[model samples]
Target: MMAAHGAPWFAGWGTLALVNAGLAQGKNRSGLGWFLLSLLLGPLATLLLVLLPKVRDRMF
Candidate 1:
């Protein structure tokens, strides 16, 4: 249902962040950064994922 509706903001974004954070770590660290960001950030993570870059570029 959510997959069909393009509501993958939760899974996909978390996965992407997790992978990126893991790659950023290079093999020593676990996915703590990923889990922390995804957990603490919550829906704000989604908002930040979508908006942070643009906000940084002053696209707002």
Candidate 2:
């Protein structure tokens, strides 16, 4: 088990990455790209993703 002091830090970042991935996908962006970016940029990436435009569905 991780140290008590380190548990929250790891869990918080992990969860943030997951949510970021989903947000990216929702925006029609690359989920994997956002997930990796979030691991480093954290909240900054989230803000950017939120400001990005959603992909429009092309129904031909």
Candidate 3:
């Protein structure tokens, strides 16, 4: 059925979202925000994360 064919795709997308979340966290970004964004943007989110610079903490 159509559902069977789409299940793997959905699973992969979900996995990618998790990976993006971790990647975001590694860059000192919000994991949950990236996770939600990834759920909507998928690979595009990964590309954005890759292109983004890491956040540095300021010692004010």
Candidate 4:
């Protein structure tokens, strides 16, 4: 768990890079917008990520 949390500095940045790449293909920029917002709003970001329709679709 410690490693997992620490992974965010590098790994999480990588994940965000990939997600940003994917978002770039679309016309709507809100996906990236929300992500940047999350960095400032941690729990809210987690909640927003959790509540996203597309994200939730994949989890279960």
Candidate 5:
């Protein structure tokens, strides 16, 4: 499917992955991990990040 559109398609996907990574970090999550996951899950990953609650900081 993506092959038909070529670089532009993958470029958009890659850009979305980067944006998702930033979103993850903003929520106190691992950006690198989420970026990797985004490569596979794409928009689904973004939906998950948006729906999930932010991690609360703990004083220990």
Candidate 6:
């Protein structure tokens, strides 16, 4: 039934995922991993990303 609305419903989530991916990369984390996680966990993944500790002593 929800499918009737199509991807539009989740379009916001997709945008959020892209933004989260960039945030993950900035934090020296895996952008792809966060992108995948956002697909399943949605906004919750974003919250987790926000709360996760940043990598110290970055190689680059």
Best by TM-score: 3
Clashes (backbone N, CA, C under 3 Å), per candidate, total 0, 0, 0, 0, 0, 0
Model 1 root mean square deviation, Cα atoms: 10.9
Model 3 stretches astray by more than 4 angstroms: 1-3, 58-60
Candidate 3 clash pair list: none
Question: Which lDDT tens digits does candidate 5 get at residues 1-60?
Answer: 446658888999999999999999999999999999999999999999999999987687
Task: Return the top candidate by lDDT.
Answer: 3
For candidate 2, the lDDT comes to 0.92
**So what's the TM-score on candidate 2?**
0.82
Query: lDDT of candidate 5 vs native?
Result: 0.95
TM-score of each: 0.34, 0.82, 0.88, 0.33, 0.87, 0.80
| Candidate 4 C-alpha error for residue 20, in Å | 0.2
Q: Write candidate 1's Cα lDDT for 1-60 as tens digits.
A: 334555576677667666545543443333566457766665565454544332122255
Give Cα-based local distance difference scores for all models. 0.53, 0.92, 0.97, 0.52, 0.95, 0.90
Residue-wise C-alpha lDDT for candidate 2, range 1-60, written one tens digit per residue: 656998899899989999999999988788999999999999999999988889887798
Clashes of 2: 0
Q: If ranked by lDDT, best first, what sequence of candidates would result?
A: 3, 5, 2, 6, 1, 4
Error of 5 at 59 (Å): 2.8
Question: What lDDT does model 6 reach?
Answer: 0.90
Candidate 4, backbone clash total: 0
| Candidate 4 lDDT over residue span 1-60, tens digit each | 345667657666556644653443242336666556645654555554554555322343
Q: In candidate 6, which residue ranges exceed 4 Å CA deviation? A: 1-4, 58-60
lDDT tens digits, residue span 1-60, model 6: 456576786898899999999999989899999999998888999999999999876576
In Å, residue 14's CA in model 1 sits off its true spot by 1.6
